[model samples]
Target: MCRNFVILLFFHICGCKELFDFRDKNKGSNCDVVFLSDSVKNGTITSPLYPSPYPARTICRYEFQGRGKERVQTIFQEFNLYHPRDDNRECDNQDTLIAFVQIEGRMEKIDTFCGSTLPRPVMSNGPRLKLEFHAVYGSRYSRGFKATFSFIQNFGIKVGVQLPDYPCAFVFNSNETRSGHFYSPNYPGFYPRDTECYYFFHGNQGEKIHLHFNYFDVEGVFPCEAKSASDYVEFSNFVSQDRKYERHCGQLGEFDIESDRRFFRVTFKSNDRLDGTGFNATYQFLDKVESFTTRSELTNETAVLKDIDGFITILFFLMIKLIR
Candidate 1:
């Protein structure tokens, strides 16, 4: 019994030693940098010494790759990096987190982030996304940042019609569905600066496209100052070069519109400067004859119901008089 107790105590001591050592490593020195795998549906990226003041002169790179039509999205849950002392709301490169997105084989979309305000969620336009975190030597090291990333599927049909050479352009046709919804790029979040996106809608013959915007908050003035450099949304019924379009901007909460023909187009343009949470809209293809015919029938039925009510009221009064 004495020998057995000695063996059990030795094993317990060894186990406790290993556990404490592992935790010590995780406390500060363990820079939790995890690379994404094809099988990984979601994961996290954190700075070295995360939750603790990160060490200076450290750099971490995270790459995300998705398959087929899947895209990458990331939301920063905790962000506290050192920025310039002037508090201008822009990072001076002392410590920063930068994102590079590859869209349509183009790397034109690059964003830089720093400071303590949590960043808006980011969605890559394509399957490839790269992130770099930098902490300059001898710079202030804060608690660092933690972000969660996942692979998500994009919306809209991608067949038949020719895709635009630019990013954020989509085509929708009635053949796929009679009704659908679309949102501004990075919607519910402030859109990127100096960006333009196009949405094309096609309907079958005898059908008109009806678009209803549930939310609209593009940054600009009402009627949109011509060439004054502000964000605005345009609606067009024609696809030709000289086709006329109506432009609107400012905080118009909700509105509805209908196309004069079977095709329609929407263009969202944003310039460098103030930005706003974009818009969300739904569209449907309505048969002109069926829609108007139903309305006409409903109107006639309402008139008949009114006449019947008046006749019943008159008959009730006459019966009361006879009883009296």
Candidate 2:
């Protein structure tokens, strides 16, 4: 009986260890940076990228926006990387790794669209990354009117490694707005939609970094009562040097608005030569005016005139009319 009890205790300890190990692996890390609506009034940063000690092959996950019963479709129209290294093989396959749905444009002629990242080369076998999506509805609606959606952005790495210290990462910043004709048949009119971008870096304590930007507006129509716009920007970073991976997602949002024309900006400066960066800006305009014209006036600049001698002719026509 004594031997059996001892054996049972040994097994119990082993089981507890296994449980703890699994829990640790799945546990979410405390976000080093988080930017959401209603938080920042306005601001900017010099260098958006932060440092991380994890191998260059770490994978990160980010979730941006969701939909409810209202039947509004959220679309990611464009994705761009700035100063990206041509040597980065991962970026070369952006079309395959980053997925998006084009609502109304050159790509397709659909009212609604949805897509996901396709299969790609894995860079590392380290900690897997997942993204969860959430959405909030307006108060004017009834029960079940407001809802939140959740999804995971998974990152797979081929090569694995044991880190001596947690890795550091950087968050990109952006600002955008949606204003134009509401293509929705449910609600029609001109409403304004705006968004701000920010980022969080989570890894080793010393490796984390945070960057933020203010909100901006676009001249177009947006859904009504859609307060606080938010979404996640997901991507895979492949380290070709060591054949590793670093997937990342930095939560970003815009909450406070104190002006009429909303505009936001992001800046980055780095001494490290390896630090790569760039940005993409897009603007869509609808033609509503019937007549448009422009003229240039001469100030302190020299003016040149040409004289032409020809049969000068002036014609004027007048007709006599009696008041009726």
Candidate 3:
């Protein structure tokens, strides 16, 4: 009976897929449904009459499914939707493209896109992602959107038993390995709002953590103040107010930082407003002695050892001659 119920549910979802067609009405059928998964790794989705003004009262749904430890990544090639005309315009109540991700069995809105401007890439927090295109009834319509979707493996490890309070918290330990890399949540994509992610790095005794950012493009201005309400990334040995470095935001070139202590912490905070393509960094666990040692000092020590060895040899030969 249980197996029969599961089968019924599977077909029920398949039947629902027929309700939304990605092609224009004249195309006759929903012949192509891009359901991304492990085997069917990647595909594309487009609005009905994409590149052309979509018909009024149109709705479409695209589903992405990934296997364990995999997440969906979507990048739009073109986007031109009916966006709000307010001074502080946004995607609200217009022809909008929205993405929702499933987390712990519940669906949550991750992002909403409109306007002619192309959007930053997006990645899901879990294995399932759904994209909905809604075009409201109106006399005027805009060219819709087209995007490519793929299932990518998630590299971040959550810090918790079963499910953590903060799903984005992760730990990098020297005992696990000497070096590794990590990225902002949905990195190379616009991160979500109201999110605070923490990355903890712990080095073995006599070691320290060194970090270098490869790419950084978070939203905000210079001297990103924590109290000023902007998205920023910060690095420190402590999690409190006595931080070792300033908050980083906006765009940055490649840079390097080393932790003063064995434990290094990185925090990324985003507000409810703007977001941009986040960052990716590489980290290494360096021994304190190796990190502080200089090449010139090592060369001088080698010269001193050679001189001592020559003096000892001469003294031994003279003592042998006197004995003879």
Candidates' TM-scores?
0.55, 0.18, 0.55
lDDT of 3 by residue, 130-169 (tens): 8887777422457778888777553233221122445467
The worst-scoring run of ten residues by lDDT in candidate 1 lies at 14-23
**What's the CA error at residue 100 for candidate 1, in Å?**
10
lDDT of model 2 at position 217: 26
Which digits, one per residue and each the tens of the lDDT, describe model 2 over residues 35-56?
Answer: 1212321122110112111111
- lDDT of candidate 2 vs native? 0.19
Clashes of each: 0, 34, 0
lDDT of 3: 0.71
Candidate 1 lDDT by residue in tens digits, 1-324: 332221211222211111111123222221213334365777777776568777666666666777766667787889988766647565775688888777446654367888777888776656777787777732345788999887765322233243546455688899998888888766765665556677889899888988888999898986676566668988888764224655778899677877888988888888755677788888888898755333456899899999999999999999999999
TM-score of 2: 0.18
Which structure among the candidates has the greatest TM-score?
Answer: 3
- Show the lowest summed lDDT stretch of 10 residues, model 2: 14-23
Off by over 4 Å in 1: 1-44, 51-74, 77-118, 123-144, 148-167, 241-245, 290-324
Q: Is candidate 2 or candidate 3 better by lDDT?
A: 3
Give candidate 3's root-mean-square deviation (CA, Å): 12.8
